[model samples]
Target: MEIYVTIKGKVEPDKMAEFNGLFDLMVAGKTGAALETYGEDTFPAAESTLEKVLDKFEAAYDSINLESYTLEQGKLTLNFMGSYALEQILPDLQVWLLACGVKDVELEGNWV
Candidate 1:
């Protein structure tokens, strides 16, 4: 099945630098300090942690495919084909996003 997982959220302007720091680092293809090692609560391990987390999910769930990933200030959308349910993905994502300074995290999905 193909699924669209849409995440709606906000990150306070003051926190934008925190979120952007990680995003920008990843977008620039750089490595950052691990979340556990970093003093800041925000997850800076963008390249490693994010993909590692997703890899863990993919390993546990067969037939999981990631099609698209999109992120912006107020919205995030992930498209994929998967046998696993949204429950398997959303909670961890919610936690990580919040730690990354994303507020009001919400998830919705459609399958086809």
Candidate 2:
């Protein structure tokens, strides 16, 4: 089975790199080390581990005035879908919007 998790948000262009980097790191491996390396002020301490990451991610989405986030958890895999408006604050932010149309699907849900 597979679970899906989606996050949506509007962010400045310059911040897209940071956001995508941190998000990728989280999906790749939501570990303390990973958070410490990619996390920013919005990211919580890694002490709580994946729980903290999820909490922080949720908060971040809320802060960005996101449209919605959907999470589906299954027996074997997890999928994420996110949708948000495009911010014109910076040109770089468009990078993150590349996945706006489709959901991000990760094969495993180690945190779950």
Candidate 3:
């Protein structure tokens, strides 16, 4: 089974830059670039915030893989794919995103 999950939200204004760097790290194959781009001082905290959400998925739902993402104008949309049922993952993901300072979190899932 192929399940697709789309998450939409806004990163708080002050957090957008670091979030963008994180997005680049995740989606653009730019590992460790966020640390350089965001500076060592700011990047660790920013990376930790992103890590909390990823660690949840990794620890509890290892099947899902974040396939892509876009962060622009304070809005973020993350696309994920996996074999797991969407309902099993969405609620915790929504909460994790909220905890990471993403506002107005919304999610949708479909199977293909």
Candidate 4:
């Protein structure tokens, strides 16, 4: 079984450098086992065990189909479907943006 999820968010175009840096970290393959998408547990230091969570997020972000995804101006949208549990990876999407905040998220298909 798999799920299709769409995430949308907003970020200042001026802050793209910071956003891209964080995003690049995820794609670079750093690994973290325990990290939260939001709240106090977010944004651990580079050496912190929780920091590896960025790796997990990058994998999921990379998994997004990208066929219908868009990131331009101040808007960002991504759509992808996979067997991975959304709870396991979806939060990573939100975590990528230090300034861009998620405005909406949609999920389709059945989940277990």
Best by TM-score: 3
List runs of model 3 lying over 4 Å from the truth. 28-64, 85-87
lDDT per residue as tens, model 1, 29-70: 343344333314465544344555556565676423445445
- Clash count per candidate: 0, 12, 0, 3
Q: Please give each candidate's TM-score.
A: 0.51, 0.34, 0.64, 0.43
Instruction: Rate residue 65 of model 4 by lDDT.
Output: 33
- List model 2 lDDT by residue over 1-112, tens digit each: 2222322344455444555555555465553555555443443333234344344445555212222232223111213433331122112222223333112422222222
Best-matching candidate per lDDT: 3
Worst 10 residues of 4 by lDDT: 31-40
lDDT, residue 39, model 3? 37
Off by over 4 Å in 4: 17-68, 92-112
Over the stretch 2-62, how does candidate 4's per-residue lDDT look in tens digits? Answer: 6666666665677555444444433343222322332123333322333433456465573
Give me the overall lDDT of model 3. 0.65
lDDT of 2 at 21: 57
- Give the C-alpha miss distance for residue 95 in model 1, angstroms: 1.1
Instruction: Sort all candidates by lDDT, best to worst.
Output: 3, 1, 4, 2
Model 1 off-target regions past 4 Å?
Answer: 17-52, 61-87
Q: lDDT of each structure? A: 0.54, 0.36, 0.65, 0.46
